[model samples]
Target: MNQLQSLKKITTVVADTGDIKFIQKYQPKDATTNPTLILQAINLSCYQNLIISAIKYAKLKGGNHQKKIVNASEKISVLIGSEILKYIPGKISTEVDARLSFNKEECIKKANSIIKMYEEEGINRSKILIKLAATWECIAAAKELKKNNINCNLTLLFSFAQARACAEAKVFLISPFVGRIYDWYKSKNPNEIYSVKKDPGVLSVRKIYKYYKENNYKTIIMGASFRRIEQILALAGCDYLTISPVLLKELENSLGVVDQILNNEKKYYKNNQSLSESEFRWHHNQDAMAVEKLSEGIRKFAKDQENLERILSKNF
Candidate 1:
């Protein structure tokens, strides 16, 4: 079997893109889309009609251009999500506005609104996972949303505290970023201080995975934003991973054998200890790497989301 096929035996592979064509090719179990991916798709020639049709449909409903544009953007998002679900049997994760990351109530409200919109389009809630940032307020919002039977995918997770809180809340999944962690370390230390095997991103996800498994936390860890195939291979046994199509294709083309690299049987220092919020916070804070990456991830997502809104304004 190919590496992609071999990896699937141990982990659920998810395509993290708005490019439907790529998802069709890789045939991932599930798919995920962020504002940036959707915005990129909107600019592509193949998907231009999707945006145009959504805009026309919005105008037909009778509203000003701005309202029409907002409606169109939402429609495009929903359409892309629904189309992605056609190929993947598992759930599709659609993110809420990163701008609302810090507001608990607003985050909850937006998540519900997005869920409602999905429901209106005949997409069942069971097959939809709402994606949110892993801020303290967002975790609190996720707790309430879980109570309402809404599943969430906590993205932008860098610290163990964020993952711990999400797992404690019984979130459906948490996407601890991988590539961004590598970027932060590489940028700060231009010197070749780390090998691919010991890349900070790989180490960070392994720590989070070990903690989750040791504690029997049901919240699934889905490593996201990978920059290289090595990072993905290092996390072969993670519950799920959302990889970009380009990396997925590269993995498909590679010849090296892929095997399970992580599991509960592995020994870890934190294996015997349970983490509390205070301990989680202090430990994560001490890891200057995690602290810096988490902040950077949030800022990047917020900026991309703003750029998406600007794109909507121009053509809507």
Candidate 2:
């Protein structure tokens, strides 16, 4: 079997793209989008007409109410999300604005707003995972949203502290980044070549997965931000791996002897634990690489969001 076919036998593969064309081609179990992916998809030549149509629909709905077209940046995100949903069989993760990552109440409000937009399109709330960065406040917001039956995908997660807090909140899922974590380490030691077996990013995720499985935490570990096919295959049996189209295509074409690298058979007895708010802050602060990368991830997404808004405003 090809790597992609082999992967499906062990893991739930998710397409990490907003481009409908590629999404249809991969037909992953689920689909996810951030502001950055939405921005890139909307600008693609094949998706331009779709973007224009969504803008037109957004303008037509212009009003003084919550559904106003002036909110096209978010509205367009939903439009893209809805289109992708048509191609996938499972949930779609639509992210909250990265700017709201630190504001629990604002993140709560924005998450509901994004959900409301999806619901307005007649999409059921169950079909969407309101994605928020795995900041302490955002995790808190997700906890609150979960009370209201809103599922959340805690994203931009880099450290065990972030992952632990999200699990404590009983959030539906957490996307612990593998590539971004690897990138930070590589930049500091460019001459060192790392294999999938010893890759820092791969190891970081395995630690979390073992912890979660050992402790029986319910939060789904959806590994994200893969740098290479080896990284993806290294995490072969994560709960879910949201893969970019480039890597997805590579997996689809390559014939390989893929094996299940992760298993839940090992039980760890080290004190099953959770981080309190202060402990969470302290642990996150102590991890220099996580601190740097998490902040950079939020900033980059926020900037990409602004760029999307500018394009929407100028053209629409």
Candidate 3:
């Protein structure tokens, strides 16, 4: 088997794009979409109709152009997510607005609204995962959602505290960012860039994985935002990973052996321990890398979300 096939045996591969066309080619178990990916798709000629139709439907619902656009964007996201679910038997993670990252109640309300929209379109709620930023408020929102049996995929996770909190809340999954971590390290030490194995992003995910396994946390860790194939290869045995279609295609054509690099059994034998909230918080606060990277990830996503709204306002 090729590396992609081999990796699948150990980890659940997920496509991290809004483009439904390429999903079947990669045969990922799950798919994830954010505002940026949906915005990118809407700009394409092939996807222009999806946007136009959403806009028309929104206008018919009686709103100003800006309101119509916002409604349309939400509709477009739901449509893309639903389409993706048709290809994969697993869940499709659709994100809430990053702008609401700080608002716990608003985030929870929006997440439930999105899930309801999906259910209205005949999509099973069980097959749809609501994606949220890993803010304290967002984590709290996810905790409540979990009680309602609504699965969540926590994005922008960079610190162990975030992971511990999510795991403690018994969330469905957490997406620990990989590429953004590397970006931070490279910015700080331009003179001595690290290789893929030693890349800060790779290490961050590994550390989070080890902690999760050691504690017997049931919340799945899904590594996200990879910049290279090497980063993905390094995380061969993560619970799941959301890789872009570009990388997915590359892995498909490459001829290489992939082996399971992480094992729960091994980690359990090596100083396994659980962490209380205070311990987890102290450890995360002490790690300058996680502290800086988590802040950076939140800021970047917030900016991207603003940019997306700007684009929608101008066009819609």
Candidate 4:
């Protein structure tokens, strides 16, 4: 078997794209999308009908111009996510506005709205994973959403504290950004030639995987945003790894031994403590890489979101 086929044997491979063609090609168990991806996908000819549908949806919904555009943006994302679900058996993570990351009430409101939209399309809530930024407020919103049976995927997760808080809040999944973390460390020490085993991003995911398993946190560790196949190979046995089509295509052709680097078996023991908001902030602050990357990721997503809104606005 090719490395992609072999890797799927141990890890749940999730397609990290908004494009239906790639998701259909890879046949990943699950699929995920962000504002950037959705924006990119909507421009393609294949999704033109979805855009037209969203424009009509916004017009019929009948709101002020800004409200109509916001509604249209949400509709486009849900429309794309619903289209994705037609091909994949597992859940599709539709993100709340990244602009709402810091607001607890708005986060919860937007999540419920997204879930409601999916339900209106005859997609059950069980098949949808509400994707949110891993801010303290988003985590808090997720905690409440969980009580109402809305599963969440906390993305842009960069620190141990973020993982701990999300798990304690009983989130369904947390995506640790492996590639971005690797990028940060590489930028700092550009001269150092880092091996796959010693890769900062791989090491970060390993640490999170070990901690979650050792503590028996039901929350899953999905190592996401990988830069190279080695990083994905190193995280072979993670709960899930959302890979882009580029890497997925590379893995499909490459022949190599894919080792299981992480396992559910817990070899070490330590007391796991829940973090208060202050503690979460302080601990996350201590890691400069995590802090910088998390902020940058959010800003990037937010900017893409605005770009998407502009597209929808033009349609109306």
**TM-score against truth, every candidate:** 0.89, 0.93, 0.89, 0.98
Candidate 1 residue pairs that clash: none
- The most accurate candidate by TM-score is 4
User: How many clashes does each candidate structure show, in the order listed?
Assistant: 0, 0, 0, 0
lDDT, candidate 3, 212-306, per-residue tens? 78767788999998998989999999999899988888888888788788778644533334456467668778878778876766676667666
Tens digits of per-residue lDDT for model 2 on 1-316?
8899899889999999887888888889999999888888887777676677767767787764334434777877888888888889999999888988889998888888888888989999899999998899999999999998899999999999998888778999999999999999999999989898779999999999998888778789999999899999998999999999999999999998678888987575645556789999999999999999999999999999888877777654
Q: TM-score for model 3? A: 0.89
How far is 131's C-alpha from truth in model 1 (Å)? 1.0
Better of 3 and 4 by lDDT: 4
Give the higher-lDDT candidate: 2 or 3: 2
User: Worst ten-residue run, lDDT, model 4?
Assistant: 266-275
Model 4, span 49-115: residue lDDT tens: 9889888988999989999999999998999999999999999999999999999999999999999
- Best by lDDT, which number? 4
- Scored by lDDT, model 4 comes in at 0.92
Stretches off by above 4 angstroms in model 3 are 63-66, 266-285, 314-316
lDDT of each: 0.83, 0.88, 0.82, 0.92
> Per-residue lDDT of 31-77 in model 1, one digit per residue for the tens?
99988888788877767777777777677766887677667766777
